[model samples]
Target: MHRTDGTRSLAGLLALWGATRLVLLLAVFKVYVFPGPDVTSDVLVIYQGWYEVLRTGTFPLDDVTWQYPPAAALPILSPALLSFLDYAHAFFVLALVADLAVLALLLGTGTRPGRTVRGARVWVAGVPLLGPTVYARYDVMVTAVAVAALIAGTRRPRLMGALAGFGALLKVWPALLLIGAVRRRAWAAAAVTAGVLTTLFALAMPGAFAFLTFQRDRGTEVESLGALVFHVARHFGWDGQVLLNYGSVEFLGPYVDAVSTGALALTGIAFGWLLLWRMTATRFLPHTLADAAFVAVLMFTTTSRVISPQYMVWLVGLAAVCLCFRRTGMRVPAALVLSASCVTMLEFPLWFSHVVASDPLGVTLLFVRNGLLVLATLVAARRLWRTTVARPRPGTPRGSAGEREGASHADADPQGLPDAADPPGLPDADPRGGPLSGARRGLTSRASRGAG
Candidate 1:
């Protein structure tokens, strides 16, 4: 029987959660989520090398054939320990664990103080398990570690920093979040983490140090959000290599010759100067750091020439991080980003070939997909513009700490969320001493803003 108010029992919801889980588990064996070659990409080559390295008792050199950093090598090396098992089967098992690790990070945040990413934990845990990208790359291992670090950062800065440091050793992106800590106490956490991570690399394998020098030569050909547009333009008539200059857009497309390089050079310096100014000017706080990083990564994506589908996972993951923070305005955008990603990524490989073969329909799909993203971005920006910060209640006492730069919507008012009248971005509402002040006493996890 249904209740008048429409809230379901915990038993009912959990039963539903379990039924979905059962269907997914059965589908994996019933259908091949991780199909052998023909469907996989070169990202797995690292996993292949790890199996070889374990058998030989040495770290394998990434001579073009294998090009990931040594930290990422650990996950691949994991399968090597299973010497008796078939390497393909080992790769599958590790992927399954990686899927589970995403869940672990999501669940790990349950005890945490912020608003949950609504249904994010459910979709993240479920969808990646069923998708082709799960099998295409061994990225999940490092990605999961990085996510765990982001979530844990609010509760335990040191633990969060350590997890991030270890993940940075595995993948370069995790190091970027350290910028969030700024010169505050969180910086201490980052420093200790860097020390621990360096020690690990130094003690276990001297070779890992040399891997950094080698990585500079092996730069990204395709990455960033802009890669999609660049590829489409090239598919038409555009030419020239796409590059990043100071973490922003510096276009070279309109020109196809030597003039393009100079244009790119100018673009890079302008963007670099802007990034430096923003970093120097903005005060560090969880909300600001999270929002800036999400946007910054998009800047990278918008300007890159090569955008692999798997790269979308990184953005979606970071967007999820933004949502978990106290910012309710970002949750809806995060939701759309997640939903669209599932559709785009799942359809890309499976339907891309058929669409290409069909030609006309593929063109239609491209139009609809790209057009939707452009429209969605506009809508998100509009919502962000209207969110004005709320005022403190009349009797609310003056806090011991100074107010943070970005004002939060969560004032003494009962409305309890960011809106058109509220501030446009993440509020630096947190004063350095806000926690100790009785005015903000009942506020739960400083990061987990209660999402409506």
Candidate 2:
């Protein structure tokens, strides 16, 4: 698409998304005020109390459980700035600003050279489709940081690292974005991340680490994919119970601990698989880092013992960033990720009672959402593998020793910057070169000469 057309389309999409979010927020806030059984705005209510505590000048208020990292205190406490606007309203406004910031970043990145409008569409469609959960939770703020990091990964390595580190302080997942950086860039980003994290930790001190103690004894949250095993087991006459625990629905009974342990093991396996893929891949495209980061987050989210509805926000945000690349090859997988976000809304506020009751509808919703996630994960992994690992066919004459060596070195660089010659499947920038270059050039010339 032309630059002007793409810009207009993105603007319209953002406008529609913003309107949908506003409508959803108004409806949710009504429920919050009226106190209804059908819809509960627990995040807003919970943060209201947290905000009150923080406003009192006592950090990490002893009366409440604050499980987030110290940097989260910034957003959590930001509502204090508008004490005149009531806690819920103030927090919602802050979240809306963060949401818009992320959208703006996506649009800016999408318009960059070698990028596409697909990423902007993902953000515009995915966020509001997830419903009010996007605004109610603080995950959107962390998402903004993540979007900025991915956009800067190729052009501004240090900035990307700094954002990732600060985002890690807000939530640990942004650190995954660094996985896409080239070796030197990766080192630079990691160093900045470490430095920022260290500074934040030193400033926050004991309170920064407090969440570790609280998280240590947490159980298997009921919404997790692993919790499905227990859900099915309950119907098979196994004795177990689901209840609210650790600020989320959780399973507690026979084999609950075992299931939780198994989930952790799966997470470890996922990490190992990511490491193995990174180490073994033979080629790297410009989209490699974004694709790799998406895979890593998918593995972490899918295998974890907690799959909060808001967690989908993280996935959606990262998936949008991945789509920004022209050759990411994640179109189908990105659609599935968006589909899962829509299902996540259904499983939450709309039919949460069904989930809590383990009704057929709730189970089906969970199944579909989790199934979509699984499919997206598999599809993305396959695309990454094919693009980076699959070798050329036999009898395809390899280039000179130097060119072959250059390809290998380039693959390992992480940045995946294009060389002067056009890549095999891509069109040449210089019209003089026609389309194909290198070995393909000789083949084309010989075929034309033979035809004559």
Top TM-score: which candidate number? Answer: 2
Residue 436, candidate 1: Cα error in Å is 12
lDDT of 2 by residue, 1-452 (tens): 67688668767887787787777678557753322232335556677676666665445645335777667778888877787987777878888888888888887877655567678778877887777777778898889888888777766777877887788878778877766566565557667766777676657444566676677678998788988887777778877888778777898998888888999999999888878776656455456777888888988898899998889989888888888877677888889989999988888767777887777888888889999988988898888776665353345343434334444443422332322222345432211211234665565345435433
lDDT of 1 at 351: 61
For every model in order, what is the number of clashing pairs?
Answer: 21, 0
Q: Least accurate stretch of 10 residues (summed lDDT) in model 1?
A: 412-421
Off by over 4 Å in 2: 1-8, 31-40, 55-64, 203-205, 390-404, 407-452
Best lDDT among the predictions, by candidate number: 2
Candidate 1, superposed: residue stretches over 4 Å from native: 1-37, 41-46, 54-58, 81-84, 108-114, 117-119, 182-185, 199-289, 354-452
